[model samples]
Target: MMKKTLTALLTVISLGLGGIGFAAQGFAMGSDSTEPAKKADDYTKAVDLIDDEEYAKAIPLLEKSIKEKGEYADALNQLGYANRKLGNWAAGMEYYLKALKLEPNHLGANEYLGELYLEQKDLASAEAQLAKLKAACGDCDEYDELEDSIDDYKDDNNIN
Candidate 1:
Protein backbone atom coordinates (compact mmCIF):
# COMPACT_ATOMS: atom_id res chain seq x y z
CA MET A 1 0.00 0.00 0.00
CA MET A 2 2.86 2.40 0.87
CA LYS A 3 4.56 1.62 -2.41
CA LYS A 4 1.34 2.31 -4.33
CA THR A 5 0.91 5.65 -2.52
CA LEU A 6 4.51 6.62 -3.30
CA THR A 7 4.00 5.68 -6.97
CA ALA A 8 0.77 7.73 -7.15
CA LEU A 9 2.46 10.75 -5.53
CA LEU A 10 5.34 10.53 -7.98
CA THR A 11 2.93 10.37 -10.90
CA VAL A 12 1.07 13.45 -9.68
CA ILE A 13 4.32 15.38 -9.15
CA SER A 14 5.59 14.49 -12.61
CA LEU A 15 2.31 15.53 -14.19
CA GLY A 16 2.37 18.83 -12.33
CA LEU A 17 5.93 19.53 -13.39
CA GLY A 18 5.09 18.62 -16.98
CA GLY A 19 2.17 21.01 -16.97
CA ILE A 20 4.40 23.81 -15.66
CA GLY A 21 7.02 23.07 -18.29
CA PHE A 22 4.41 23.17 -21.04
CA ALA A 23 3.04 26.46 -19.77
CA ALA A 24 6.49 28.01 -19.69
CA GLN A 25 7.27 26.83 -23.21
CA GLY A 26 3.97 28.21 -24.51
CA PHE A 27 4.63 31.57 -22.92
CA ALA A 28 8.06 31.72 -24.49
CA MET A 29 6.74 30.72 -27.88
CA GLY A 30 3.97 33.27 -27.68
CA SER A 31 6.42 36.08 -26.92
CA ASP A 32 9.57 35.13 -28.81
CA SER A 33 8.10 33.72 -32.02
CA THR A 34 8.98 34.74 -35.56
CA GLU A 35 5.42 35.94 -36.24
CA PRO A 36 6.70 39.52 -36.26
CA ALA A 37 8.73 38.86 -39.39
CA LYS A 38 5.61 38.27 -41.48
CA LYS A 39 3.92 41.30 -39.94
CA ALA A 40 7.06 43.35 -40.57
CA ASP A 41 6.92 42.48 -44.27
CA ASP A 42 3.37 43.79 -44.39
CA TYR A 43 4.44 46.87 -42.45
CA THR A 44 7.25 47.55 -44.89
CA LYS A 45 4.87 47.34 -47.83
CA ALA A 46 2.45 49.67 -46.08
CA VAL A 47 5.26 52.13 -45.40
CA ASP A 48 6.13 52.19 -49.08
CA LEU A 49 2.53 53.05 -49.88
CA ILE A 50 2.54 55.74 -47.22
CA ASP A 51 5.73 57.19 -48.63
CA ASP A 52 4.00 57.51 -51.99
CA GLU A 53 1.20 59.37 -50.17
CA GLU A 54 -1.16 56.57 -51.06
CA TYR A 55 -2.81 56.50 -47.66
CA ALA A 56 -5.88 54.64 -48.81
CA LYS A 57 -3.72 51.84 -50.15
CA ALA A 58 -1.63 51.80 -46.98
CA ILE A 59 -4.44 51.56 -44.46
CA PRO A 60 -5.53 48.02 -45.21
CA LEU A 61 -1.97 46.76 -45.14
CA LEU A 62 -1.25 48.51 -41.88
CA GLU A 63 -4.43 47.02 -40.42
CA LYS A 64 -3.33 43.55 -41.48
CA SER A 65 0.11 44.08 -39.94
CA ILE A 66 -1.37 45.18 -36.63
CA LYS A 67 -3.92 42.39 -36.59
CA GLU A 68 -1.25 39.77 -37.18
CA LYS A 69 1.35 41.08 -34.75
CA GLY A 70 -0.95 42.43 -32.11
CA GLU A 71 0.24 45.66 -30.32
CA TYR A 72 2.69 46.44 -33.09
CA ALA A 73 3.67 50.02 -32.34
CA ASP A 74 5.13 50.95 -35.71
CA ALA A 75 2.15 49.52 -37.58
CA LEU A 76 -0.25 51.33 -35.27
CA ASN A 77 1.66 54.59 -35.76
CA GLN A 78 1.51 54.18 -39.52
CA LEU A 79 -2.20 53.45 -39.36
CA GLY A 80 -2.64 56.73 -37.51
CA TYR A 81 -0.64 58.55 -40.17
CA ALA A 82 -2.60 57.04 -43.03
CA ASN A 83 -5.94 57.77 -41.36
CA ARG A 84 -4.93 61.33 -40.59
CA LYS A 85 -3.76 61.88 -44.16
CA LEU A 86 -7.13 60.62 -45.33
CA GLY A 87 -8.79 63.23 -43.06
CA ASN A 88 -10.11 60.64 -40.63
CA TRP A 89 -9.05 62.54 -37.53
CA ALA A 90 -10.96 60.52 -34.95
CA ALA A 91 -9.78 57.19 -36.26
CA GLY A 92 -6.28 58.49 -36.57
CA MET A 93 -6.26 59.67 -32.98
CA GLU A 94 -7.50 56.30 -31.81
CA TYR A 95 -4.72 54.49 -33.63
CA TYR A 96 -2.09 56.93 -32.37
CA LEU A 97 -3.32 56.53 -28.82
CA LYS A 98 -3.12 52.76 -29.12
CA ALA A 99 0.43 53.02 -30.39
CA LEU A 100 1.36 55.31 -27.53
CA LYS A 101 -0.16 52.90 -25.03
CA LEU A 102 1.97 50.13 -26.45
CA GLU A 103 5.12 52.27 -26.56
CA PRO A 104 4.86 55.64 -24.97
CA ASN A 105 8.17 56.69 -26.46
CA HIS A 106 7.03 56.03 -30.03
CA LEU A 107 8.55 58.91 -31.97
CA GLY A 108 6.28 58.61 -35.02
CA ALA A 109 3.09 58.56 -33.00
CA ASN A 110 4.12 61.64 -31.02
CA GLU A 111 5.03 63.57 -34.14
CA TYR A 112 1.98 62.53 -36.14
CA LEU A 113 -0.44 62.99 -33.28
CA GLY A 114 1.00 66.43 -32.72
CA GLU A 115 0.32 67.22 -36.36
CA LEU A 116 -3.24 66.01 -35.95
CA TYR A 117 -3.72 68.30 -32.96
CA LEU A 118 -2.36 71.21 -34.95
CA GLU A 119 -4.86 70.47 -37.71
CA GLN A 120 -7.64 70.53 -35.13
CA LYS A 121 -6.31 73.88 -33.85
CA ASP A 122 -5.36 72.36 -30.53
CA LEU A 123 -2.02 74.08 -30.04
CA ALA A 124 -1.80 73.21 -26.36
CA SER A 125 -2.20 69.50 -27.04
CA ALA A 126 0.23 69.68 -29.91
CA GLU A 127 2.79 71.34 -27.67
CA ALA A 128 2.22 68.61 -25.10
CA GLN A 129 3.07 65.98 -27.67
CA LEU A 130 6.16 67.90 -28.62
CA ALA A 131 7.24 67.91 -24.99
CA LYS A 132 6.77 64.15 -24.85
CA LEU A 133 8.91 63.70 -27.96
CA LYS A 134 11.57 65.95 -26.53
CA ALA A 135 11.58 63.93 -23.34
CA ALA A 136 11.88 60.71 -25.30
CA CYS A 137 14.61 61.77 -27.73
CA GLY A 138 16.08 65.16 -27.13
CA ASP A 139 17.62 65.75 -30.59
CA CYS A 140 15.75 63.27 -32.74
CA ASP A 141 14.14 63.92 -36.10
CA GLU A 142 10.69 63.39 -34.62
CA TYR A 143 11.23 66.18 -32.13
CA ASP A 144 12.58 68.48 -34.82
CA GLU A 145 9.67 67.74 -37.14
CA LEU A 146 7.03 68.40 -34.51
CA GLU A 147 8.86 71.48 -33.28
CA ASP A 148 8.95 72.88 -36.79
CA SER A 149 5.27 72.16 -37.24
CA ILE A 150 4.46 73.88 -33.98
CA ASP A 151 6.54 76.84 -35.03
CA ASP A 152 4.65 77.00 -38.29
CA TYR A 153 1.39 76.81 -36.41
CA LYS A 154 2.39 79.72 -34.22
CA ASP A 155 3.55 81.78 -37.17
CA ASP A 156 0.37 81.02 -39.09
CA ASN A 157 -1.86 81.89 -36.16
CA ASN A 158 0.29 84.86 -35.08
CA ILE A 159 0.30 83.35 -31.58
CA ASN A 160 3.62 85.11 -30.80
Candidate 2:
Protein backbone atom coordinates (compact mmCIF):
# COMPACT_ATOMS: atom_id res chain seq x y z
CA MET A 1 0.00 0.00 0.00
CA MET A 2 2.80 2.42 0.92
CA LYS A 3 4.61 1.63 -2.37
CA LYS A 4 1.44 2.26 -4.35
CA THR A 5 0.92 5.57 -2.51
CA LEU A 6 4.52 6.60 -3.23
CA THR A 7 4.10 5.67 -6.89
CA ALA A 8 0.88 7.71 -7.13
CA LEU A 9 2.51 10.74 -5.54
CA LEU A 10 5.44 10.45 -7.92
CA THR A 11 3.09 10.24 -10.86
CA VAL A 12 1.21 13.35 -9.70
CA ILE A 13 4.44 15.29 -9.21
CA SER A 14 5.72 14.22 -12.64
CA LEU A 15 2.49 15.25 -14.33
CA GLY A 16 2.49 18.58 -12.54
CA LEU A 17 6.03 19.32 -13.64
CA GLY A 18 5.27 18.24 -17.17
CA GLY A 19 2.24 20.53 -17.27
CA ILE A 20 4.31 23.41 -15.99
CA GLY A 21 6.99 22.80 -18.61
CA PHE A 22 4.40 22.81 -21.37
CA ALA A 23 2.79 25.97 -20.04
CA ALA A 24 6.11 27.75 -19.91
CA GLN A 25 6.88 26.75 -23.46
CA GLY A 26 3.47 27.86 -24.63
CA PHE A 27 3.80 31.21 -22.90
CA ALA A 28 7.17 31.74 -24.47
CA MET A 29 5.81 31.04 -27.94
CA GLY A 30 2.40 32.68 -27.69
CA SER A 31 2.37 36.42 -28.41
CA ASP A 32 6.02 37.24 -28.86
CA SER A 33 6.64 34.54 -31.43
CA THR A 34 3.49 35.02 -33.47
CA GLU A 35 3.42 38.81 -33.42
CA PRO A 36 6.23 39.27 -35.97
CA ALA A 37 4.45 37.07 -38.51
CA LYS A 38 1.25 39.08 -38.18
CA LYS A 39 3.18 42.31 -38.41
CA ALA A 40 4.99 41.08 -41.51
CA ASP A 41 1.69 40.25 -43.21
CA ASP A 42 0.35 43.69 -42.41
CA TYR A 43 3.56 45.33 -43.57
CA THR A 44 3.48 43.43 -46.83
CA LYS A 45 -0.12 44.42 -47.48
CA ALA A 46 0.71 48.01 -46.65
CA VAL A 47 3.66 47.97 -49.03
CA ASP A 48 1.53 46.62 -51.86
CA LEU A 49 -0.99 49.37 -51.27
CA ILE A 50 1.75 51.94 -51.20
CA ASP A 51 3.16 50.58 -54.44
CA ASP A 52 -0.26 51.09 -55.95
CA GLU A 53 -0.13 54.69 -54.69
CA GLU A 54 -3.02 54.00 -52.34
CA TYR A 55 -1.62 55.85 -49.33
CA ALA A 56 -5.00 56.06 -47.61
CA LYS A 57 -5.46 52.32 -47.84
CA ALA A 58 -1.93 51.65 -46.63
CA ILE A 59 -2.05 53.83 -43.52
CA PRO A 60 -4.30 51.62 -41.44
CA LEU A 61 -2.31 48.51 -42.28
CA LEU A 62 0.97 50.24 -41.46
CA GLU A 63 -0.49 51.50 -38.23
CA LYS A 64 -1.63 48.00 -37.34
CA SER A 65 1.76 46.58 -38.22
CA ILE A 66 3.53 49.15 -36.08
CA LYS A 67 1.24 48.39 -33.18
CA GLU A 68 1.88 44.67 -33.48
CA LYS A 69 5.63 45.07 -33.83
CA GLY A 70 6.50 47.92 -31.59
CA GLU A 71 9.70 49.75 -32.54
CA TYR A 72 9.51 48.28 -36.02
CA ALA A 73 11.69 50.75 -37.88
CA ASP A 74 10.71 49.57 -41.35
CA ALA A 75 7.01 49.78 -40.59
CA LEU A 76 7.47 53.21 -39.08
CA ASN A 77 9.38 54.39 -42.14
CA GLN A 78 6.69 53.05 -44.46
CA LEU A 79 4.04 54.74 -42.33
CA GLY A 80 5.92 57.99 -42.77
CA TYR A 81 6.05 57.48 -46.53
CA ALA A 82 2.34 56.75 -46.76
CA ASN A 83 1.49 59.79 -44.68
CA ARG A 84 3.80 61.98 -46.74
CA LYS A 85 2.29 60.71 -49.98
CA LEU A 86 -1.15 61.57 -48.61
CA GLY A 87 0.06 65.11 -47.86
CA ASN A 88 0.01 64.51 -44.12
CA TRP A 89 3.44 66.02 -43.59
CA ALA A 90 3.12 66.37 -39.82
CA ALA A 91 2.11 62.75 -39.36
CA GLY A 92 4.82 61.63 -41.74
CA MET A 93 7.45 63.57 -39.80
CA GLU A 94 6.28 62.05 -36.55
CA TYR A 95 6.55 58.49 -37.80
CA TYR A 96 9.86 59.18 -39.52
CA LEU A 97 11.28 60.64 -36.33
CA LYS A 98 10.09 57.63 -34.39
CA ALA A 99 11.72 55.30 -36.88
CA LEU A 100 14.97 57.26 -36.84
CA LYS A 101 14.98 57.22 -33.07
CA LEU A 102 14.63 53.46 -33.11
CA GLU A 103 17.20 52.97 -35.86
CA PRO A 104 19.38 55.94 -36.64
CA ASN A 105 20.95 54.13 -39.57
CA HIS A 106 17.70 53.14 -41.22
CA LEU A 107 18.07 54.01 -44.89
CA GLY A 108 14.43 54.58 -45.75
CA ALA A 109 13.73 56.61 -42.62
CA ASN A 110 16.63 58.94 -43.34
CA GLU A 111 15.56 59.37 -46.95
CA TYR A 112 11.87 59.94 -46.23
CA LEU A 113 12.58 62.21 -43.30
CA GLY A 114 14.92 64.21 -45.51
CA GLU A 115 12.15 64.57 -48.05
CA LEU A 116 9.75 65.67 -45.33
CA TYR A 117 12.23 68.29 -44.19
CA LEU A 118 12.46 69.55 -47.73
CA GLU A 119 8.68 69.78 -47.91
CA GLN A 120 8.71 71.80 -44.71
CA LYS A 121 11.52 73.97 -46.09
CA ASP A 122 13.83 72.83 -43.33
CA LEU A 123 16.87 72.60 -45.56
CA ALA A 124 19.38 72.21 -42.74
CA SER A 125 17.52 69.34 -41.19
CA ALA A 126 17.07 67.71 -44.56
CA GLU A 127 20.78 68.05 -45.26
CA ALA A 128 21.50 66.45 -41.91
CA GLN A 129 19.38 63.45 -42.78
CA LEU A 130 21.11 63.24 -46.14
CA ALA A 131 24.44 63.27 -44.36
CA LYS A 132 23.30 60.42 -42.17
CA LEU A 133 22.27 58.40 -45.18
CA LYS A 134 25.60 59.13 -46.80
CA ALA A 135 27.38 57.87 -43.71
CA ALA A 136 25.21 54.78 -43.63
CA CYS A 137 25.79 53.86 -47.27
CA GLY A 138 27.88 56.14 -49.39
CA ASP A 139 26.67 55.04 -52.82
CA CYS A 140 23.39 53.43 -51.91
CA ASP A 141 20.18 54.25 -53.74
CA GLU A 142 18.75 55.95 -50.67
CA TYR A 143 21.69 58.33 -50.49
CA ASP A 144 21.50 59.08 -54.20
CA GLU A 145 17.75 59.63 -54.14
CA LEU A 146 17.87 61.96 -51.15
CA GLU A 147 20.83 63.81 -52.69
CA ASP A 148 18.81 64.38 -55.84
CA SER A 149 15.83 65.57 -53.84
CA ILE A 150 18.00 68.01 -51.94
CA ASP A 151 19.47 69.28 -55.17
CA ASP A 152 16.00 69.78 -56.59
CA TYR A 153 14.91 71.55 -53.47
CA LYS A 154 17.90 73.88 -53.72
CA ASP A 155 17.23 74.55 -57.39
CA ASP A 156 13.57 75.25 -56.73
CA ASN A 157 14.40 77.67 -53.95
CA ASN A 158 17.60 79.16 -55.47
CA ILE A 159 19.58 77.93 -52.44
CA ASN A 160 22.68 77.01 -54.49
Candidate 3:
Protein backbone atom coordinates (compact mmCIF):
# COMPACT_ATOMS: atom_id res chain seq x y z
CA MET A 1 0.00 0.00 0.00
CA MET A 2 2.75 2.38 0.91
CA LYS A 3 4.63 1.58 -2.29
CA LYS A 4 1.50 2.19 -4.35
CA THR A 5 0.94 5.52 -2.67
CA LEU A 6 4.48 6.59 -3.34
CA THR A 7 4.20 5.56 -6.97
CA ALA A 8 1.00 7.59 -7.37
CA LEU A 9 2.61 10.64 -5.86
CA LEU A 10 5.61 10.36 -8.11
CA THR A 11 3.46 9.93 -11.18
CA VAL A 12 1.39 12.98 -10.34
CA ILE A 13 4.46 15.10 -9.80
CA SER A 14 5.96 13.96 -13.10
CA LEU A 15 2.84 14.71 -15.12
CA GLY A 16 2.48 18.09 -13.48
CA LEU A 17 5.90 19.03 -14.72
CA GLY A 18 5.55 17.71 -18.24
CA GLY A 19 4.50 19.78 -21.29
CA ILE A 20 1.68 21.02 -19.08
CA GLY A 21 4.26 22.92 -17.13
CA PHE A 22 5.82 24.54 -20.19
CA ALA A 23 4.16 27.92 -19.87
CA ALA A 24 4.28 28.13 -16.10
CA GLN A 25 7.97 27.33 -16.20
CA GLY A 26 8.31 30.93 -17.42
CA PHE A 27 10.55 30.00 -20.25
CA ALA A 28 7.83 31.51 -22.47
CA MET A 29 4.53 32.34 -20.79
CA GLY A 30 5.06 29.02 -19.06
CA SER A 31 2.40 26.28 -19.25
CA ASP A 32 -0.14 28.24 -17.25
CA SER A 33 -2.59 31.06 -17.92
CA THR A 34 -1.75 33.33 -15.06
CA GLU A 35 -0.05 36.59 -16.01
CA PRO A 36 3.55 37.15 -15.21
CA ALA A 37 4.72 40.03 -13.01
CA LYS A 38 5.11 43.43 -14.64
CA LYS A 39 8.81 42.94 -15.05
CA ALA A 40 8.20 39.62 -16.78
CA ASP A 41 5.40 40.79 -19.03
CA ASP A 42 7.70 41.25 -21.98
CA TYR A 43 8.30 37.53 -22.06
CA THR A 44 4.62 36.85 -21.64
CA LYS A 45 3.65 39.25 -24.41
CA ALA A 46 6.32 37.82 -26.66
CA VAL A 47 4.76 34.41 -26.28
CA ASP A 48 1.41 35.85 -27.32
CA LEU A 49 3.00 37.39 -30.39
CA ILE A 50 4.52 34.09 -31.37
CA ASP A 51 1.14 32.42 -31.10
CA ASP A 52 -0.33 35.04 -33.40
CA GLU A 53 2.34 34.22 -36.01
CA GLU A 54 3.78 37.66 -35.76
CA TYR A 55 7.29 36.32 -35.89
CA ALA A 56 8.61 39.56 -37.32
CA LYS A 57 6.83 41.52 -34.66
CA ALA A 58 7.97 39.03 -32.04
CA ILE A 59 11.62 39.57 -32.81
CA PRO A 60 12.28 42.63 -30.72
CA LEU A 61 9.82 41.55 -28.07
CA LEU A 62 11.63 38.26 -27.60
CA GLU A 63 14.96 40.01 -27.74
CA LYS A 64 13.86 42.36 -25.02
CA SER A 65 12.43 39.52 -22.97
CA ILE A 66 15.74 37.69 -23.08
CA LYS A 67 17.56 40.89 -22.28
CA GLU A 68 15.40 41.07 -19.20
CA LYS A 69 15.67 37.35 -18.46
CA GLY A 70 18.61 35.85 -20.23
CA GLU A 71 18.01 32.39 -18.86
CA TYR A 72 14.37 32.18 -19.81
CA ALA A 73 14.40 29.03 -21.92
CA ASP A 74 10.82 29.50 -23.08
CA ALA A 75 11.53 32.90 -24.51
CA LEU A 76 14.63 31.53 -26.13
CA ASN A 77 12.70 28.64 -27.61
CA GLN A 78 9.96 30.90 -28.96
CA LEU A 79 12.51 33.26 -30.37
CA GLY A 80 14.01 30.33 -32.21
CA TYR A 81 10.64 29.45 -33.66
CA ALA A 82 9.98 33.02 -34.63
CA ASN A 83 13.29 33.28 -36.35
CA ARG A 84 12.72 30.01 -38.14
CA LYS A 85 9.44 31.27 -39.54
CA LEU A 86 11.13 34.46 -40.66
CA GLY A 87 13.63 32.41 -42.72
CA ASN A 88 16.38 33.03 -40.21
CA TRP A 89 17.09 29.33 -39.84
CA ALA A 90 20.56 29.73 -38.40
CA ALA A 91 19.58 32.13 -35.66
CA GLY A 92 16.36 30.20 -34.97
CA MET A 93 18.29 27.01 -34.45
CA GLU A 94 20.80 28.77 -32.24
CA TYR A 95 18.06 29.85 -29.86
CA TYR A 96 16.51 26.38 -29.87
CA LEU A 97 19.73 24.83 -28.64
CA LYS A 98 20.06 27.64 -26.13
CA ALA A 99 16.66 26.73 -24.70
CA LEU A 100 17.68 23.09 -24.46
CA LYS A 101 20.83 24.09 -22.64
CA LEU A 102 18.71 25.84 -20.07
CA GLU A 103 16.25 22.94 -19.71
CA PRO A 104 17.77 19.69 -20.87
CA ASN A 105 14.52 17.72 -20.83
CA HIS A 106 12.35 20.35 -22.40
CA LEU A 107 10.38 18.18 -24.85
CA GLY A 108 9.31 20.87 -27.31
CA ALA A 109 12.79 22.31 -27.34
CA ASN A 110 14.29 18.88 -27.86
CA GLU A 111 11.95 17.99 -30.71
CA TYR A 112 12.48 21.31 -32.44
CA LEU A 113 16.22 21.02 -32.02
CA GLY A 114 16.15 17.62 -33.64
CA GLU A 115 14.12 18.97 -36.53
CA LEU A 116 16.53 21.85 -37.03
CA TYR A 117 19.52 19.54 -36.95
CA LEU A 118 17.91 17.37 -39.54
CA GLU A 119 17.48 20.45 -41.68
CA GLN A 120 21.21 21.19 -41.46
CA LYS A 121 22.15 17.59 -42.35
CA ASP A 122 23.32 17.06 -38.79
CA LEU A 123 21.93 13.57 -38.32
CA ALA A 124 24.12 12.73 -35.35
CA SER A 125 22.82 15.63 -33.30
CA ALA A 126 19.24 14.99 -34.36
CA GLU A 127 19.53 11.34 -33.48
CA ALA A 128 21.04 12.18 -30.11
CA GLN A 129 18.18 14.52 -29.24
CA LEU A 130 15.54 12.08 -30.52
CA ALA A 131 17.06 9.35 -28.38
CA LYS A 132 16.87 11.57 -25.33
CA LEU A 133 13.24 12.41 -26.06
CA LYS A 134 12.37 8.74 -26.59
CA ALA A 135 13.86 7.89 -23.24
CA ALA A 136 12.33 10.74 -21.23
CA CYS A 137 8.99 11.45 -22.86
CA GLY A 138 5.97 10.97 -20.64
CA ASP A 139 2.89 10.94 -22.88
CA CYS A 140 4.81 11.11 -26.15
CA ASP A 141 1.81 13.22 -26.95
CA GLU A 142 3.73 15.76 -29.03
CA TYR A 143 6.09 13.36 -30.75
CA ASP A 144 3.69 11.55 -33.01
CA GLU A 145 4.92 12.82 -36.41
CA LEU A 146 8.31 13.98 -35.12
CA GLU A 147 9.87 10.52 -35.11
CA ASP A 148 8.54 9.77 -38.55
CA SER A 149 9.92 13.06 -39.81
CA ILE A 150 13.37 12.17 -38.53
CA ASP A 151 13.23 8.85 -40.29
CA ASP A 152 12.20 10.59 -43.48
CA TYR A 153 15.05 13.04 -43.14
CA LYS A 154 17.56 10.23 -42.78
CA ASP A 155 16.21 8.43 -45.83
CA ASP A 156 16.36 11.65 -47.84
CA ASN A 157 19.90 12.30 -46.68
CA ASN A 158 21.02 8.69 -47.03
CA ILE A 159 22.27 9.10 -43.50
CA ASN A 160 22.27 5.37 -42.93
> 37-58 in candidate 2: lDDT tens per residue?
5466878898899999999999
lDDT of 2: 0.85
Cα error of candidate 1 at position 49, Å: 0.3
Structural similarity to truth (TM-score) of each candidate = 0.76, 0.74, 0.65
* Pairs with backbone N, CA or C atoms under 3 Å apart (clashes), candidate 1: none
Q: TM-score of model 1 relative to the true fold?
A: 0.76
RMSD of 2: 9.6
Give the lowest summed-lDDT range of ten residues in model 3.
Answer: 30-39
- Among these predictions, the greatest TM-score belongs to 1
- The residue ranges of model 2 lying beyond 4 angstroms of the native Cα positions read 1-38
Query: What lDDT does each candidate get?
Result: 0.87, 0.85, 0.75
Give the per-residue lDDT digits (tens) of candidate 3, residues 16-71: 87866775565764352223552367776777888888889888987886677555
Those runs of model 3 whose alpha carbons end farther than 4 Å from true positions after fitting are 1-39, 152-160
